[model samples]
Target: MSRKKEVAGSPQRAVRGPAFGYIRVSTQSQGQTGISLEAQRGAIETFSQAMGYDLIEVLDDVASGMGPESFCSRRGLRSALEAANSNNAVVIVLAWDRLTRYSKFENQLRKIAFDPNRVVCIEEVELRQNGSKAAIHKYNEVMGQRISSGTKAALDRLRSNGVVLGNPSMKTSVQPLGAQAYSRKSTDLVRQIADMLMESDDPFSVPSSTVVIKLKERGIRTMQSKEWTASRLREPLKKARRLIEEREAPEPPPTFGMF
Candidate 1:
């Protein structure tokens, strides 16, 4: 196999170093859709090739960009940062948000791991070291403030409009203002599961494995069209049991001695 050689007289070829690529998507759906992992990898590869950098490795994650905890918990990000720091290599990302949504976290990462001269984002941003530092700093400040205020405003609007924003099980949307949309099949499955749990001596304490076995016997598959694992059935079963208990709980008697 013939190894590709760098073309002569290319500016990028003249400026070369080891480059570590990092990519991320907030959800599985995002990983499957446009700007997917594959797309990000391609972009990174192209940039690395053009810059004549030895592409060390591409690290990735399917995680939210909400906060520092989210970024810290990502195994790939940790490994990538460690590798880049140890190798004294540049870290490349497709965009700024791919690195972090939080500006504070981004700044901290730059101070600790990312060298402004080495870290490169494919997107045309003012933060590039080659750009005017003073101008970029002012621009970044204004843009960061705007983005933060905008996000806060959006969240406030959602809260005011009664939209559930977090975990699916914990989410409850009001009608008229918001819709509590559940598929018919899912509703029926949950109800059946609830009934099965209610038959146990203590529904809340019932093992998820037992529920999974029952579900399997019934030939019922999850919304994802897969056999239920213990973890998969846990939350739905718990919610079902809660609903059943609420329905079965007795009402208090009306007081008749009021003067």
Candidate 2:
């Protein structure tokens, strides 16, 4: 047989199967920072070609590493799961955490009802197979739960010490504003509004519409990559107290409210 024919005839040769790739960017900044959907697709395609697998599909979503508590909230992720389950193609991801942060993702996995044995997680290598899937998921669930609980406890302790939480650390990377930086801008605007409010004659006294208009004039914007409205303005304004005040202050008179 010819060398090509002989190589093709070898049963011991590696053969990649049909595969599906999934990518997610939690922040708009990630989308523009070049780890975008297209970039992910290209990487997955390269990986698939190198391994000789046929690239069948790509699934992605924009969601945070917070938790899968938002599993239902993400249409793209839901569709990705459905595609993976329905098709026998290998479901590939850049990382497991891209699926969700540890805590609630295991619960979501369990609820998904796919055959545990048929599942495989591949990073630089295949991490697990279907038979080990359930056990691995359980382990992840336990770890995530423990971490989440520990985080809550830590935050509570910090609160008791009067330390601020969720406020960004100065060491973190600064994100830009607008469609490319939704959460960052929204957070900044809320903080600014909060400062204005808590220092006002009455924090709750300002109309939401008025606050939004004021915010726009000052170049404030929403996290959803859009302008704020009266009702929408009310939400972030309400959240301002939570973000600005780590814990509730003792009730002073509703007026004279510099607690």
Candidate 3:
């Protein structure tokens, strides 16, 4: 009878509800600079506010991937996930990298679908342009390639210049760019080029000459239709904002070397 009662009772499980958000920054600098914990919270709050999600808890971890194990693998993160699973709470996050920077592990998380949607990685995946499904995928792929190649080239150039890169302790020495080094117009052009390049998935990957010709045939400009040239399309990115117009916020100034 006891055994039967045990079988009949089973384990009573209470339905869970969405209640927590999880955020993480890989390195101390990333936590402080590029992807600050505060920035993560702000972004999450903005997203939640717009989407109407009841965010009741936040789990923030400041851990770097020194090896294979991720910050998500920590006990605190594990406990948070368990609680969310039991409560069926949606775990809101700012970007997939914030939760798990490693692509492979992030993929694993995607595979293990949790009830109440375990995580929400905002700004991690680029949305396809409104159009045919096939076209959107193709466009995104191309853009991603261009951006990646451009970034790689920029990093390589920096390395060649012998500038110290990375955190202070583990940094390699290199020269630093000085103030008043670049002209305003030049800076603007650099910025435009960088924007175009960053938006592109591969710096080397671009529409073929024929495609460019066709676009020109259709009266479309190759970035600068006023004076179209292959060189124009391949220039480095830089910014040209007026010094006076630049925001003078003292609290959170953008610093270099975060990358």
Candidate 4:
């Protein structure tokens, strides 16, 4: 790792493949909470070798990831993007959060004409394979429905009227993508509730409100760790329906009829 390829004074170079490596540590010392700097490098190095990404340089950053972050704030990120632009290499991070805590990470990627598709998050890719990203993506879809309006509303209404909006039938199976800093509680609960409803003698008649009550009676909570509500159940409920359709799973044993 010490073999320097010298990307304008970058000290670390792992391989000579087409990919670039970037790692970050929010804590001042490597001993702080979460993955140490070396661990990230090791992962990125191994990934690059296996994937044939000639990782020339691995930029590092150590700073508090608070509030909105910009390329100007993190010199390492800025350098990585610049190098990516010049080398036409994709940037690699151990995880998306390590790249930047900011919600609008695309802003930085957009600046250097970097192909957003090329910015690979190793863990996220694995999660997609595991079907674990399903619930998180469902949450994001719900958020979009809440925030996007006007023309978006028009498009949605049109689609509801039987207008085609892309391929509505296309889908990828997603499982819960949870790691040390994440949790699969939300996904697991959603699937469980879905199974319960499906196993019911008459699932269509089982009011979601009543279901919420049953959940509270059982001391179950939402992904936010709050009491579940009928409205709160909407998105995940739809997701459950999709799973039932996609999986065509046999009716599981009665799991929630005891209530």
| Candidate 3, superposed: residue stretches over 4 Å from native | 1-17, 32-35, 65-68, 71-76, 103-117, 124-259
Q: Which ten residues in a row have the lowest lDDT in candidate 4?
A: 172-181
Candidate 4 Cα errors over 4 Å, as ranges: 1-17, 31-35, 126-259
Give one digit per residue, the lDDT tens place, for model 4 in 1-259. Answer: 2223332443454544476778787767652532456566666665565554677888877865555654568778778878888887888787778777777767656766777887878777563432224323433444344456446878989988988886443443232222422446656877788787777876657788878887788887877788888898888777766766666657757885776
> Model 2: residues >4 Å from true position, as ranges?
1-15, 32-34, 115-122, 126-259
Q: Distance (Å) between predicted and true CA of 143, model 3?
A: 24
- Please estimate how well model 3 matches the true structure, expressed as its whole-model Cα lDDT: 0.50
- Model 2 root-mean-square deviation: 22.1
The per-prediction CA RMSD against the true structure, in angstroms, equals 19.9, 22.1, 22.1, 22.6
lDDT order of candidates, top first: 1, 4, 2, 3
Cα-based TM-score, every candidate:
0.41, 0.39, 0.38, 0.42
lDDT of 4: 0.67
By TM-score, the candidates rank as 4, 1, 2, 3
Count of backbone collisions within predicted model 4: 8
- TM-score of predicted structure 4: 0.42
**Across residues 108-221, which tens digit of lDDT does each residue of candidate 3 receive?**
545545542456655534541221233324434554665687789999999999987777743233223322344544565545444443444553344545334543564645
Q: Please report, as a residue range, the 10-residue window in candidate 3 with the lowest summed lDDT.
A: 1-10
